[model samples]
Target: MKIRVEKPKRPAFLVPAVIIFLVIAAVFFAVHSFTETSVPLAYEITGFEGQVQIFDLSNHEWRDPRRGEEFKAGQKIRTGVDGILNLQVENSVRLRVKENSMLVNRECKLQKEVEIYRLGLDEGVIFGAMAKNLDRKIADNKAEFVVSTPQFDAKPFGALFRIQASEKADENRVGVLRGVVEVSRPGSLSGKGPMFNVRALEEAEVMEGRVQSPAKISAETWQELKEGYELLAKSAVMEAEQIDLAQKAGNFFEKAVFDHGTFFTPKVGYAGREFFKDPDSGEVYLETEYDVFPAGSFVGVYIKTRDFDISKYEGLIFDARRKGDEGFPDSFFIELKSKGSVLRKYSARGFLREWTPVDFKFNAQKPTLINEVVFVFTNERVGESKKGVLEFRNFTLTPKKDPVPVAPAIPVNVTDIVSPPEIQSTPVSEPSAAPSNQTSGQETFDEMVPQTISLG
Candidate 1:
């Protein structure tokens, strides 16, 4: 009885201290759970080829990544001269990094009501496609995909787009193929400069920290954008098929004009060129009208090849058709030139009003360097018509061996001309002064064709 009575009284602060400790632990657990839930899953590399290398933030080293490997935020990817990398994010967005590109994953977050992805492009081009209705899981859900560059940032709203950046030149270009892309300078995002909205089939450029006005995309750029979107669409369903198809398609686009060529029309008076997209089939093509002043004058368009090694390729392939019911010249010439001299000249005949596939196999003597590809139209072939419209698209170099069968190759005869003849018109110094006769509703030929060449 005496020992029980000797029990000491409990300290006043002990209970309160225990309660405070419990409250602090509860707060810490809640914050940690929130962070875990807010973090986004890693991006999955679906396919890659050539010298694609990845730099991991955790490892701090660049390593060759395999298909199906996961890439996390803070990681960087660099593609070599022939490299291509394909990635999938949250099953809703697909990205293709073109050759000689460097991309960095800055932020990726997927929450119950919102998904955010931000990427940094240091150099080269990247194609992106965001699936429509990505927020179908929740009515209030939203998604934001942004690509930041040295000069500008591109924000796409469930669209297909391409963003190119040149850190060396401090230039950025944004092109949209299917939807709208908001292009803004880095300072403009903070309400400094004006923002530009580039819509479907349009492009905008940013140089010297200024965003240029949006304009229609060129035929070559359109083809590049279309090919990239098609590749992503085809691979959306199956991962295994995606890897195989992406490699093959990547190789094809690398050598073709779609990746590193400049399509342009010479500053001549006889020809007017414009890019047209078919509303029905969604096919993009180059439409050219030739108005030969003299009965025998010639007109043409040129694609700068940038001296790509076509030794692995067998020949040239393209699609052409006559616009409307107008009769086209039976003789169409395709000349491969190196340095200003014609390397090989091939002539094709029998073009129909409907689209026809034309392929020309190189002769035994293939040039080691091909600087330009010219499509020449001579009024002499059409006799006294002296005027015609032609549509062309899908100009590519055929691989030496293709697994799938292609259209029957048309027989092309070699021409003896060593060089193209000079035009007989005075050069118009101003684009506005260009003849508006053929391009009434379209942009002037001089304005439509870019004077400076960009190798992809």
Candidate 2:
């Protein structure tokens, strides 16, 4: 009877049911954990030129204070900040992302002989040097650097980007300093089909969720883009100009100086100097009437323009030459001034034995309408009293088409430190005992005229 009472009959399905329950519990835990703690893929942001950053999935947040923090790819980030994030690209280039920006690097693919990287720039600004991969067509041309944004795109090489502003604007805007760039929808019909190749440097505007044609952009914005390109492009020219300006003594306006019977002294100080080219000699160099030593040193020139409004020109362009050591100083520099204030500075670093064209902006990302120009030579290698040779030619300040009307010139009273009334072209014996009365005028020859050469 006791045995028959039977072990409480075990349910036939009890074991299997327990096992199933356990499995179900494990699955639930796994799913919950995944949903709670998983994150997007992170980008491998490193290169010879610099490092990169990724933003977390936070919209409309500022990252300025938290810069230098690592961000994973696919994690969304919005730039409410107002600064630039600098990253290295090529061994020789840098990439800078500005504030209020949204961008992502989708992929970095390295194939058998190709290294391809794709980036999605939603909004903001980017500045960097261009790299030439041995496997890509870029190595052949070098000038085609690619910049993509929601509204604009560009390719800037052998140059620098001072600023790129892409706020919620009426149009997509992209500009370059030196090299050429191509802009198009990578594979969109608006940019043509995937089979079609896009054109380089297309000026388009992004407005109301649509990218409009370049013709629709405002004159002011167009002027900004043009000015930006000029500023970036000027770096190379300034480098070459140093050599040309250093070699000559009297620069270009020797006739004007002699005709006016005014003695020109060397103004070798930092702020005030001029680079002039002979209208007839075709040789160019720096000129001043303040006897200061510029031997074996880098000096800059400042051109005081007539009281005229500068808003009309998008930028400045000129020609220059150098005949010194094959590769002397690596670069040259230029600066501008307005209303007794400094306007802009441009540096062109490279060689220029042949007459090369150079362009730079008076105001990048905007137009700074003023009438003064300054040329600067860096003291990169020169000691005291060293001589360098450089020549400038065919300088022109052409205004952008339909530029804002030139502003009327403002009369400025500049006080000079050196005032030698007479300049003797003939080398005076024993340097004429360091003249004491140093009172200089804007132009040593009170009547020096601005020089220009036709581009055509």
Listed in order, each prediction's TM-score against the native is: 0.47, 0.34
Error of 1 at 202 (Å): 0.5
**Per-residue C-alpha lDDT of model 2 across residues 1-456, encoded as one tens digit per residue:** 355455677889999999999999999999976663422323323321222234445774433324344444344444445534544433334555556666666544443333444455677666544432321344543212344565444444343333343555643455432233344443342355321111122244445434444332233433343323211122346545644454353322211111111112223222222344545575654432111123333444554445344445556665665533211334544545557655444566444677677766433333344455555454443222122344455455565576478889987667745676986697657755775754342232122223221222
True-structure lDDT of candidate 1: 0.66
What is the lDDT for 218 in model 1? 62
Point out where model 2 deviates above 4 Å: 1-53, 56-77, 128-137, 141-145, 151-171, 186-203, 207-456
RMSD of 2: 24.5
Output the TM-score of candidate 1. Answer: 0.47
lDDT of 1 by residue, 275-322 (tens): 434445655566665544243457776655554665557766667887
CA lDDT, every prediction? 0.66, 0.43
